[model samples]
Target chain A: MIAQFPALQVVIPLLGAPLCIILRRGALPWLIALLVSWAALAMAATLLSQVADGEIISYALGGWLAPLGIEYRIDTLNAFMLLLVAGTSSAVLPFAYKSVAKEIPQDRHYLFYSGFLLMLTGLLGMAITGDAFNVFVFIEISSLSSYAMIAMGRDRRALSAAFTYLVMGTVGATFFLIGVGLIYAVTGTLNMADLAERLPPLYQSRTVLAAFAFISVGILLKLALFPLHLWLPNAYTYAPSVVTAFLAATATKVAIYLLLRFGYTVFGAEFVFNIVPASEVLLTLALAGVIIASFVAIFQSDVKRLLAYSSVAQIGYIILGISYANVTGLTASIVHIFNHAVTKGALFLVMGCVAYAAGACRLESFAGLGKRMPLTMAAFVIAGLSLIGVPLTAGFISKWYLVLGAMEKGWWPVAAVILATSLLAAVYVWRVVEIAYFRDAPADAPPLSDPPLALLVPTWVLTGACVYFGIETSLSLGFAEQAAIQLMGGG
Target chain B: MKHHLIPRVIAKLTIPGILLFALYVQFHGDYGPGGGFQAGVIFGAGFILYGLVFGLENLRKVAPPQIVTAFIAVGVLLYGGVGVVSQILGANYLDYDVLSAVDHDGQHLGILLVELGVGITVAAVMMTIFMTFAGRLR
Candidate 1:
């Protein structure tokens, strides 16, 4: 049973999905998904603990040897991601019940839960798998389900948003396939660890360069980095509230991990920074995404859309850390991967609670939410403080590492730019707070109460995590540091 | 014989032309970087075209989604299963030399099974996706 932990990490949700669909009763699937996700989280923690102590767990499917067979390899880097993904999924499931009921019709609820579970299975599999081609397979499984989940929104525009996402997602997946094909040609192996060993010898080859270009572009599209992010805002806005929360918390974080894994580990830091011009491109885009997305977020009428755009900007901070391309920089990127997931999950879950109470998430809909739903709004406020990187929040720790990394590189301008972006974040988050607290309530609005405990508990759980992890850097920063060292060392 | 013969003949002749190209790429995989995935897709496309022209009900009679899904899992299982066998034979996971009753034969046999597994999984999943979408429309 202990030896099977790696397979169990994926098999639980992968098998649990069809079982969820078969059961098809109200609340049952959600409960089952919650249990399975928590199981995965526990497994992930054990794996991460093992890896942090310098152990690598490689589980072969059916006992096949590597360089010829598929492998699931767990190191500090992937184990951290496995924990982030599974942890977020379990947290989001409790909230999904009420939120899904309110937004998705009863008839479609079972399918929605099924899709959610399948998406979880795909994401976890992607994060944990050691084979490069397996990543593409899991990515497609997740993307197809994601498109379906997004389109299930009651809003008609959800359809078009899903369609646009499909087109872009397919193109991205294809690009990744092309890159894998090229790598396979050069190294004759699909296992990532083997490729890392084989690629450095062929570092000067044009073929490897082509593979890097394809994979980088593919991952960039999936991460929804600034220029390639056109499909995200509408998709987030139009999705059912539960779907948006799940994706915002988990999906892009997986993409960022994939980017870091490939760029730093598989390709090596020297090849990434020296041979390819990834650093400069990442820096320019990070700055633009932060400044432009913040300005855009301030003006949005719809709250979900505003947060969606804010997500794009937040991704910039992660990329900015990577652009620094050093130990502190990599640590910043990795730490933020965990911190941002907590902050955004809390914020979006709170948004869902408010929408459940007020019947809408438009900025004006929150006119008097401060009084109507004190607890949920407080969660929002705490999460907002995290978003702005206020002290004693997880967001601040990620930013501190980022700023330190920039200063270490003697890039004072970059450090200044990061500080300036935090100020812009303050402005947008302040706009939401002012509307909720200070504006007069709409006269016709009926009195409302706080969201049911089922939703609020998970919302506060993540908000609590945001603050807890902020004060306790031992786990997040320690895990991040070890992972960064592994990444920098090309392990 | 005529009823089965006509479709079989058309399939045998035309499908071979298409699959001939697929096999070319599958074998050329090691040399020029093409392999099981492309070959599998091409072979699956032939079956899909058969279903489309001959109606899905007819296709389902021969190969259903349940079977396809099972094949998908089994394909992965087969791939994984091979690795376990190698380990039991006193080698690391996927060490093909352990695969043979004799030494050198193991590499070729291992590669064949791996590719066969890839081809099976790819084709099955392709058909499964098509069936799922078609079912949604209905």
Candidate 2:
């Protein structure tokens, strides 16, 4: 029973999705989703503990041998990701109850929950599976459901957003499939561990190199890394508030997990850095993404779009950590996966609350909101501070590790870029703060209050986690370090 | 209207055969290339042909949106339920060897059930998507 935890972690949510539709009631599906999320969270926590001492749990489907069967392999890295993905969903679903109700029509409520659960299953399945092709299948499942959920947003533009995402996402997924197919064509095995062993010997082959390039570009697009990020801003901005919050926090983080998994685990650090100029390319892109995206974020009038661009910049920081290819650097990347998810989840949930109360997410809509919705606005401020990497917050801890990683590499300029970007982050965050606190509300502004406790509680839960994880640091940082060591040590 | 009669008659005559072939493809998946996905598409195509020939209103009357929506869930649940049953049998999830006394028997049972689940869901979802898109025209 205990050994089955790895499979149950994904299967529970996969089953819950269809169950939501079967029940066919508005609130019942939400209730089922909430329960499924908590169950997944508990499963993730257990998996993390099991893997804490550096043990790996491998469950073979249908009791077949691993190379021949689909495997759910758990180690420090995926376990940590499982915790992040599941934990974020658990936190976001409570807030989703109110925000979704307000944003989506009553009739489609069950469909929304079904889509949400399907997305959850996809993320969890992607993290858990050891078969490379399985990741593509799960990615499609999640991507398709997300398109549906995004299109369900009340705004007519939501349809275009979904369509755009569908186009970009299909291209990305196709590239990924092509890469996986190429690797399988070369190695004749789809299991990741087998590929890791088989790939190094074929590292010099052009076919392998092409496979790597395709996979990297596919993952970068999915991660919305800078130049490939055109589809994101509109998708996040136009999607319903709950959908925005959920995707903002979990989707890109999962994509980053794939980037790290393939780059370090499958490709091998020595081959990636020494054989190819992959590190240099990653470093260049990360720097560009941070600078360009942050500059763009500062000018956006729509708060959701602003945060969407901010998400691109934040992803740059994660890639920067990965580009270093050291233990501390990878730890920074791994830890930021959790820290950023919590921080961004809180910020987006706060935005959802504002949208719930004020009925818009435009910057002007936030004017004088600090007085009208103090608790909700305060949650935003705390989360925004974290985003700016203020001291004593989750964001600061990741940035600190990122800088230390840079200095460890004797890249002083890289460290400077890190700090400069924090200030850039501050500029964009302050733009909202000034609008919410200083400017007067418009004459036609409806009298607004803090969102219902259903929304506020989850927002603060994540907000409080941002500070708690920042101060404690042991859990997130500890797991991240262990996972980083495993990746760098070529697990 | 008179011109439509021939196509509608052909569709009515051929629909049962398409459905029968779909079932054959679905059940034959364990030993052959055909599987739930192929079967599901065939099943969906049969209904789509009915709609195209007899009109969508007639098709909806035959299948109905509510039941088609429910079938989607039922299919997935059927698939997932098999996994849960394996878990209950004291093996890992989807570990079909525990489903019966003979290991091969369990594998057969597990694969058949899961494929059935997949077939049902895919067919229903395909129909749903077609209806949603076509319904928008009205």
TM-score of chain B of each: 0.78, 0.96
List DockQ for all candidates: 0.11, 0.79
Candidate 1 wrongly placed segments (more than 4 Å): B1-138
lDDT of 2 by residue, A354-453 (tens): 8889888999999999999999999999999999998899999999999999999999899999999899999999999999999989888789999889
Cα-based lDDT for every prediction:
0.86, 0.92
> iRMS for model 1?
6.0
| Model 1: how far residue A3 lies from native, Å | 1.9
A98-163 in candidate 1: lDDT tens per residue? 888889889777678778878998999899898999999999989999999999987899999999
Model 2 ranges off by over 4 Å? B1-3, B31-33
Error of 2 at A482 (Å): 0.5
Model 1: per-residue Cα lDDT at residue A85: 91
Q: What is the iRMSD of the candidate numbered 2?
A: 1.0
* Candidate 1 residue-pair clash tally: 12
